[model samples]
Target: MAATLNEIYNARSIALIGASQDPNKAGYQVLKLLLDEGYEGKVYPVHPKEPEILGRKCYPSILDIPDAVDVMVVAVSAKVVINVMKQAEQRGDVKGAVVLSAGFAETGVPELVEAEAELVRIAKRAGIRVFGPNCIGMAYPALKLNTGFAPGIKLIEGSAAYVSQSGAFGGALLMFAGDQPCPQGFAKFGHIGNMCDVSNLELIEAFNNDPSVSVTGAYMEAVKDGRELMRIAAASEKPNLILKVGRSSLGAAAAMSHTGSLAGSDKVYDGAFKQCGIVRMDTVEDMTDGMKAVASLPKPKGNRVCVLTEAGGMGIVSMDTIDKTDLVLASIAGDTLAKLEETLPSMAMICKPDGYIDMTAAVSPEQQAESLRLVLADPGVDAVLLMGLPPIFRDAKDTAERISPVAKEFDKPVAVCFMRGESMAEGRRHFEENGIMTFDTPERAVKALETLYRAAFRNGHPLEDLPPAPRHHLVEKAVAQGRNLLEPEAVSLLADNGIPTVDHAFATSSEEAQDAAERFGGPVVLKVVSPDVIHKSDAGGVKVNIRSRSEMADAYDAMMSEVASRVPGADIHGAMIVPLAEPGTEIIIGMVRDPQFGPTIMFGLGGIFVEVFKDVSFRVAPFNEEVALDMIKETKAFELLGGVRGETARDVGSLVDLLVKVSRMAATQPEISEIDLNPVRIYERGLAVLDARIILSCGN
Candidate 1:
């Protein structure tokens, strides 16, 4: 049977090939690290020449090793790497392999790429789960193992598991981190280069299931399957923080619809991560900051944070930083604020601006603890961010000692920012020793609290509804007709899915338009319906405010003429004649099928606001009601929906229902590429979907 993840990654015994006496070589360096770190397992070295290296007996090959090997570490040239795998297969003692060789797919050479693929095939047949052919390696410090050849990289035993895409650069970065006094530590570390064998998703799945992993992180250049990533990250209970690079625009030249035009790949990733409870880190520094908070602190109850500072500048800086994050300053209770004012020093400014406190340098260690207890007990506070400078007279250690116990009394997380390195060194040391995280800068400290909040609040709130079955007929019809669904057909589909569109009638002539207008006994709107014309307004095919028969006739003639001149040789269908929707808030609900992540729903302000501001939010298909409401609240349109400018509140609950139904429709209909419902007039009681467009992918 194939080895499980624990057997493969947490192997008790290892066979290190290319064992060398030369310290400069990677093989020699790797052996020294393993032996020096006191790996709690048997070390079997394989070498053709050296009989004994670093006090470990060397065999010519793994096949010659007498003891059963739980895993094999191959550090050899690319040309001869397959030969080692052959030996691993023949040995039968090998359970897993970590090929440390380069010159595979990473080189972008055709021959090397094929060689890597062939390597996976061979390893799979032998039931050996291979890590990398052009990668650094793996490290599980709890097991006292550092299997990679990256020298000077310290793997501290922590709850976070880190995976990287680039081995050399990633490994060097980790090495740099290790060189520092307080390095960014991890429980498991490895790089999945080229990913011909094991991918980042596989590692994420492994981490998600592993009990030892408290939170997970990765450095990804690009993702091949964003849908699967959403699924895996959504399922993971622990926080999944990823530093996704390549935030530039997509490679596509143009899009068929507005939904596709605004669907930047990076935006899709951002929205998908938010929906799935993945913490998207911006830089390597951000990852380090997020890791410390996620690893050390307790999960915060909410995003509300109270900032307590010994310096005014630090408090100001912290509040400014909090303004940009998902975190909000906690509104200290009135009674609590009164207590803080009475107990603290005369210089202390209590709640001068909402959730802030300026204790000044005059405060002592005892007062600090008392203040911490008061805020921790307050119902408004969910977390605490304490910023302290060097005390004027008292020792810094005294402040740390007094505050640590009070901070630990409550389950809420606390992040300490102690500035002036050497001056506050004792205080910072005490905080670290007491299991409270410390940061040098106010920005980094704020980030730690923000990450903690997201972990506790944003992670894993996905809707459990199963995806509806795919509608094959719609795809087949679109393909057979060689065009996307018509506006009428799109409207019909929405109605079938229980979304109410406007009252309208199809009109080929001006008489039909007038008749449709008379049915409403008010002004009507004429929108050209054609599968060929995606943008009716851009093509001069839309006419509104037609009151009488004469106006309808004139508008019909002018619109047809303009459309003909603008788009020549286009097959034009009849226009949709409907009553002008009652005045209400306009919203744009759309769906864009991302290449990596399929069918994502978008919500934002309608008309010019969406076009100009691009203020929108997205959720993956078939999301829950909570996710749906979050998407609405994330955009500027949310304010307008909640009775803006003396207007009555629009039907937000009805809108949420509409969004859920649309998400289900998009999720079930796999052939659909885009769904745009622009100028969806949302009233106080109901909504009117004035225009609808659904694009189907014929590529299948």
Candidate 2:
């Protein structure tokens, strides 16, 4: 990977294999681009057919070139790439090779795949890095370098560096960057074709460590080393904007065929991105929006945003957008209101969406700047959104420039939304040029502000360290027996681990069930335990709240009969007679091993709503109490836990502790495949696991 980056950056002398004199050929275009783009490097065209091409002495082969080349760009056929590479490797100074040839594994051609693999192996042996077998190559704008056949265009030089797997996509992004009116930033856009060695993770890590780069963006089809990427993203302080294509099933299949990638489940990607703190965007526009926001906006103190707009409708829209995100609309502080009162009319309403400021009456830049300054000074406002009407302000550009310095003075992120059409383009450009984030629409501005707030706040509040998990007795026994834990076994394991479970006893027969129910006391619960039936409730294998021994005996028989009827071929492992747990707030605590982020803990409203409502929050495993508490509070069900209506708030602290413990367990035990503790009853005093299941790795 070091070799790859160096080869791309410091290629003082390059050998272009299959170089042609014909102007229309890709080889000719590549050489022309290098010269046109002001690449200071020397060029050696390797062509067996021509003695001289493009006003330069052409070598028959790389071996024949008198001078050693720093990098080799192979544009020959796939079959000839290896041969060319072998010749290039013979040169002592040949450090890296970018194979622009196609017909690799992407075509699903067996022979070509082998040829590509051989190219990788030869390059590896030669200690030379390979870029792509089917790629658009790379460009370094700051250095004025262009290596592939892609067109020569002015690449934006700033902080954001972009990497993609698709050559066409990378080229398109470069072209878009050149065309779009974006903030100045250094960008390293490249394609990772047939990533045999160099991968997305390596590039991200490089950019993250690079002093020139302040932010990183990626358009990845699939992660080659997901764990490595997650680790890098999680540890890096720079904001990362990732747009992962092929999120849907159809798109995943298409991506698989296009790049030979495994675009895993969307849920897994969501969990992984959340855990790593990587801002995931759905489209290219969103990616740019996020990047611009990060580049221009100041780090917000918190997620609370205060909107001060001239148009009430735009303010309402901004409020709606804020509600959609994690950002809260802060109440106006008294000092802020007082400041605004002196500047504005008596009838002005200075609330959260403080749009009562008369923009029509104030045509002066000073008035607009004063309005903005007053809003930003509010102690409760962490960030401010200003919706500017270009037609109303006489000097829109002056107003934008004036507002920028005042916003900086207050040390707050002030985003401007130009409500007018192309007429406001000048004003928008002025604001953007002055480092004030300006968006075309209110929603876009709000989104950028929200992302800025999230990135800023996320930096300080790191995931907390988790508590020690309870030892699972049944899990240990099951590990010895080489079996998955059913509900009863899982419950016993939870009890062993220090997690409270409802008191239960295994019964082999109806008579035993009756006896166990008598011993357990009133309101017994009967559940038929079977190795084959993981979802007992769904299979009619569970019977809850049996008051008497007679009821228990009948329920045990009925549950067994029902389970047998429903499953038909399931082998019942007898019944579990337990004391019925008192009704309380039901919550779920589960662990899923995310492919990219490793183990992740999930918390949400438990019971059937866990699936139906899908109100869940996730954090990477090994989280501390603080992180666990944040995850719990982040959920919509937090209101319920805080005693909604007449209900008493459950012991949320206990739940957070339990989550931390579970996360630690997941992190420590690699063999534990999954942990599902549904309906973890949260009482005012404590919590109890009503049902649990632990699925261990098959190898374990």
Model 2, position 677: C-alpha lDDT score: 84
Which candidate tops lDDT?
A: 1
For model 2, what is the error of residue 393's alpha carbon versus the real structure, in angstroms, after optimal superposition? 9.4
lDDT of 2 at 366: 72
Predictions: Cα RMSD each: 2.6, 4.7
- Please list the C-alpha lDDT of all candidates, in the order they appear: 0.83, 0.74
- Across 399-441, the per-residue lDDT of candidate 2 in tens digits comes to 6777778877877888888764666767877777777877768
Candidate No. with top TM-score = 1
Off by over 4 Å in 2: 1-7, 22-25, 51-54, 149-153, 180-183, 248-264, 304-313, 330-358, 376-381, 392-410, 419-422, 460-482
Lowest lDDT sum, 10 consecutive residues, model 2, at 254-263
Q: Model 2: what TM-score?
A: 0.88
- The Cα error of candidate 2 at residue 267, in Å, is 2.6
